[model samples]
Target: MNQPSTPASWRMWLASGQPRTLGIIAQTISTVISLMCALLFLAIAFGWYMDPLLALHLFLGAILCLAFIHRTGNPLGTKNMTFAGALLALLSIACCGYLVFEQGRLSERLPVLDPLTDLDLVVSVVLLILVLEATRRCIGMTLVVLVSVFLMYGIWGDQIDGPFYHRALSLEEMADHLVFTTEGLFGPALDVAALLVFVFVIFGALFDRFGGGNFFHDIAQSLVGNQHGAPAKVSVISSALYGSVSGSPTADVVTTGSFTIPLMVRDGFSKVRASAIEAAASTGGSLLPPVMGSAAFLMSDFTGIAYSEIIIAAVFPAVFYFFCVYMSVNNHAMRHNLGASNKNQLPRFWHVLRKDWAYLVPLITIIWAVLALNRPAFAAALACLGMLPVFLTKSQYRQGFFKNLIKGLAKGVERVILVGVACAAAGLVVGTLSMTDLTGKISSAMFALASGSYVLTIITAVAVIVILGMGMPVPAVYALSAVLAAPALIALGTDVLSAHLFIVYFCALSAITPPVAVAAFAAASISGSNPMVIAVTACRIGLIAFIIPLIFLIRPELLLQGSPTDIIATITSTLIGCWALSGVTEGYLLGHLSKASRWLLAILTALIFIANSWISLAIGLCTLIFIYARRHQAQR
Candidate 1:
């Protein structure tokens, strides 16, 4: 009998390096042949006789990768489970691949008709449902249930309630749209995933091998780790590092929270405070640039914006967000009388730098390449890989080069699995919406409810984003918002970039909001705090998230939408706005604020920030000064 499969965590590799595991990983010889056969037949059936073998090969490659992943316990599978999963995964690949290849090949010859063939129709529907289920198993039951509801609406539209109700499409039509066309399921979402998202995943993995994590941690430590609230600040910086690479808030929290949360607690931070700080900071990572929480690429494909522009647009908001979190931690430190680092106790900055200086070069090179070249994700991946040799030359880190390399690659691939599936599953959502014109209905209804009030429209849109974000990750959150709320933003006369980024910011903030806060959940697991308490604190600390979106919505120039002077003005004003807002939220400037002063400053700062006029900025500054003077006098 075959040995049992292991879990996908690091511990599993240590427990068993069994030979069978490798074969299972390779999906054995028989499984590969079966998958290849499936693809060959699929290609022939699709009338791709001219390039039958080539199409079959691509399909086979997809299937083999799918089978290897399934067999590796990467998904919820075992040895026996692998055999069946490999077969099913192979079949699904063949079906989807043939559909894509055939569609391309037939475009010039003949238009592929609805429910093109009986075989195609049945396989597409079956495979779609399977993909959804696979996504549910890997991510959560929430998205599956959500998509199921959508499918139900399409099938039973006449019976549904509310303005959302409409005549339903037949099952055949639904399947045909979802599987065969770009409108339904086999759409840009999946295309972006297959092409762009995977490369970034590899890029992120390569960064890790180049000691990107250590570089981030050391830099954060050197800069902020000696402050009064050093641990909290470190959490912010480290989360940014992980966020830029991982692109998931929950993943960021898990990666950095274990170290930072314990450090914060040991250094006299409350469990709730420490966990909240980490949670809020980690969630902000998705909003950070270069990697930007993984939505920039998707946003580009969906909105026709440049990827570099998304990165540029996100830079200030992300900075403002982390600044707010840092301020919260600073205020907490002051309130609790947390002491600053003892010079003798703190690690020597120069020593830390000298020790790991080489590790830092790769990250710098990556950022330079991205901004300077404006190249694709693959270019970034190549740059990162090219820099790895320099990092490996360090004597201390050299011993584990190969080990880290493999681990990073494996982790990166594993990270992409659920995300890849989520995108595919979201294709179902996008596919259904496009096919049924459900987005138009939702948008029109949202508009009717707002009745031309921009504020009300924004409120409703944000509420939807927050609600959707609770059960989904950032990509899915943005996907749902892009489908539903984006049109609402466009209708309000907002720039397309600002509108989508606004939706994305709100969706990203949800990871720190109450109820189903994934980041807070991860932090709380380590800090032993009540998840809700941590989540509420996280929301408070991440207040800039709420404000920045409003800023971009009001002043689209903030998203790098204007001339050079306009861009400079927007950035300057936004930075000042952030400072004032941070001061207000902390209830401190020169000293602690009185209750009245805090409220006044908060109101004035928001007014000025949103007003975006010089006069408003001047008045806001005066109020800030007044608060500071009053606090200074009281302290004296």
Candidate 2:
């Protein structure tokens, strides 16, 4: 009898190494571990009996192991494991395993009251090192260095003479606080990551695996592929849809930009402008509602706000963000006289809907479950489960269903390791800040520096968030900002929700900010343009994003915090302001604008956005009308 054939995935796994059996075993073990961890979180989401600490320990352990196995080196370049990586992976297992077995006993021991045993101390120290190392490997040195600074501060803070100084912490005290207690590596940040964020990541991974991405792209193309500037508009719509679920702007650019950027260039846009447009559009995805990025989940956890409430409040700002992008693209298309896409090449809207409409059910399930049922984690879990029937309905998905399920689950776990490790690292920062009372000191320093001016405080916070966000991921940036700058904003009389949302806005924007614009860089790779040029163009295209956060900060009604009339009025004025700003930025309204007209429009837009009163609104209207008449007379 002929030997049975190995599965394609198994063959693919074994193709990476010299020892076939070893590769098979390693792949099997990793897949099993990932699945088991995923199932554990799923069970916990369904109210399974497990200690929260144990769950976090399991999550951190498996993620660290996977991180070491999949990535090597400090800057995280290599995808294959080396001997050193294997050793680190083993160490991660042993260290985390100790806590996993002893979690119950450790949980009952009062932190700082009960002295740790030698082995306990050893495990704590090793686990802390492993977390930092894994963070360095998976995320990069930026976060690792930030976490290290916090650790060093926790150790020698008492030696400092300034107001920032705090009481000294011993090695054992630091280890116990960060490793043994829930306040450190196992805090709300990790808790949220292990449960809420992980489930959503799985949902997104499986959704993409099962053709939701194609469905979204097709739908967008069908809707706008025949319009002028069709490619850029498709990038905005598709990236917004995908980014809502994928939640990573860089990943969104890589996924959708591969198609949209080339199309934009083919249509008429410059390579740099095309890349920048995609980057800006993808960056806005995290701010979109229904299903937002992982940082939004962190926001819900950090602010004690419901996920549904956050998404609901995000509606106006998110809409206005896309509106600005769309208006900018429309003007550019008009200016360049870009023609509509070939009608024959566009997908039929009804045909796409009729065929792939089932893909939307999972997304709708998430929105309904979160809003109607108020169970965000369960909502994500249900969406993942809901994908099965939808997958079964399609022959391509139904074939090799079991293998695809395994592959999707494993890929989901792998994809989340960066986020998981980042959250754990963020926990270290939060733990240190809490232990040292550094957050209060920083907030006080900021307050004094701003001299009790809320606008100045906001500006300072924005600068800090964007700078911190430069090389860091959104989760880390938001976590750091939430603890540091947000407290300052709240102290200066900003609303709690607004302050946190303000931090989130800047965090997302940093992906396109210059010097280290991750999203723009990713787009440049596809567009074959200079990354900095793309970053500059993206900043111009996304200028409205920077302003929208400030608008909501001034008018809380923009976040749905006021009466119906107030909400409506704020949204209307902001939309008009965004339109005028887009005109100023693009130098095109009814026609190409002269420098004088652009300046006049810019001033009126500033007046409208800054004053937020009837007089400003009337003046803005008159200015717009005057500009329109002048342009019309010129056209005649």
Candidate 3:
């Protein structure tokens, strides 16, 4: 027979020859990374300083991402690739450990090792290549290509000979700057990942593996299960709650949509629409507080703001986004008579809460520590985590408590490694900007390109963020965009909070953005609908949520920064804006909206968004009265 094609031939040879070995090796490395993380987390939770912890995280990241290359592989895999992977993993552990051991010497402000150790130089070059390869394997070729372009720019910036050009730098100088300093791979991005984001991610994993999902279900069902479109509404609320913890929108969909989507279809919704609602609601979860996952922690690092302050700032937009989804589902219910269960059949909210109310104590503790005590992110999460053992006292949780606890801890470790690796990869981009001072160049380019139109600049910023976010996870996308795109907004007078959340909002939306909508794709797998169809529907269903950041930009008060009166006013108008916006998008109000009316409602909503607070409030109130009156009258 003719030789198989390259992909098939590779698979055949790999399957027969090296499959089990690579698989075993990858699993073994992943487990070790998990174990290392356990040690590191315990070390920090017990009150150690963060300097050494950073080194341990980076070390595990290097080893884990390299081994992921073996697990996830490339076309170039060979018997040699496996050997090379093992060698790289071992050397990486040694190299990153060396950096950690010598962090005092490798300080960002300290003098470079002028000549550089031969071993350091070799490790830097080899480790950089391996990191690039690992980034390719775990993230995508796009990031690898983007980082390569930055590396090239940092090295050869002098040749450009323009306002953007920099002085000549030798290869050794570049390597020293990129490797031995915090200017590159072990910078703020990784620092935040190690210090805060990793801990929260572990806490989230632990919460989920313990019983967070069931609590969300009980709570959501109590609130909306008797309403019209109960299934969709439940998805909205539950996804928002659970999504806050599980920042991966696609994973959230698979977890909750497995329950919500089927019920929606059985309750008179189409598969596409059901999937769209779940995907959109799930997408907003990462924007929710507690663990806005990586973006929120990084925001704290980037803004030099306290994590508690960031949490407070984040609450209104997150609530407003979910409110928009809840309204859309409520509107659809009115239009289709969708959500009614017999009151008798539904679980009583109080009864459910009383039964598993213990499950909520951890989250409540976390929120209280953040909002009330102003504890740091890690401390807040750790406080809640410590209370989890309290659940073991209950008979319902006693069995398998230790078993699930260990598994949850392991899952957290695995997740942090992924985040750690991504952060290291992000640091490459950050380092290039700092080393070459390219941020100023790029910001100048954007300013010139926008020609001073603030709206166009903000739009361009969002587009850049969305495009960058298309294939990468939100944190990686946010990290890159914070360096690349967020400056455009800041240059145009957007505040740091607005600029950061502005990027984060779009990155979360990317889960339902077309062409590469990962959450919609997961929903499609469940609903058996076309992913593109689901994505488009999701954009329409959640379209109002898309404008929320803009609303915040229009009125900073919406971010909870201004006076209580201003904050309350902005929130009231925005909530009303959401009602009109969602009504327009769903083509429903109290009852089905005429097409022309939807257009009118949409235009009026946009105007409400840009108007002065009083005017916006007036318009918002009028729009709400109009929709609510029509629906209420029709019901009568």
Candidate numbers, best TM-score first, in rank order: 2, 3, 1
Candidate 1 lDDT, 598-621, residue by residue in tens:
787787777767675455556656
- TM-score of each model, in listed order: 0.85, 0.94, 0.90
Ranking by lDDT: 2, 3, 1
lDDT of 2 by residue, 1-636 (tens): 966655864433322122112366568878988899888887877767777788888888899888777765533123444678789889998988998888778878899899999999988888888888777766666777888998999999999998988877899999888887778889988888888889988888889888888999999999988988999999999999999988889889999999999989999999999999999999999888755668878899889998889888898899999999999998889888998899999999999988887897898888889899988889999888889767778998898788888888887898788788888999999999989999999889888988998878888888889888876678878888999999888876789888898888899899999888989889988978999999999999999999988888888988999888777667777878888888899999878998998998888888878775455567667776877897888889
Candidate 3 weakest lDDT stretch, 10 residues = 13-22
Which has the higher TM-score value, candidate number 2 or candidate number 3? 2
lDDT of 3: 0.76
On TM-score, the candidate that comes out on top is 2
Q: Write the per-residue lDDT of candidate 3 for residues 1-636, one digit (tens) a residue.
A: 866468766544333122223456566666566666765755675476666545544655454544443434544345333665566667667766666666665554444545776776786787787677666655556667778888898888899977889988777787887776666776778777776676677777777777778879878888888889988999999998888887778778999999999999999999999999999999888889877756888887787777777777889888878888888888877887775766787888899877777776777777776677664554645554654654564565577776676677667776665567677777888888887888877777777878989987887777777777775677877888888777778867888888888888898788899888989999999999999999999998878667888888878888887788877778888888887887887787767888777887888798788887778888888887777777687788
Give the poorly placed runs of model 3, Cα more than 4 Å off.
1-29, 50-70, 74-88, 101-113, 339-345, 387-390, 394-396, 628-636
- Each prediction's Cα lDDT score? 0.71, 0.85, 0.76
Error of 1 at 299 (Å): 1.3
Off by over 4 Å in 1: 1-115, 158-168, 345-353, 396-403, 562-573
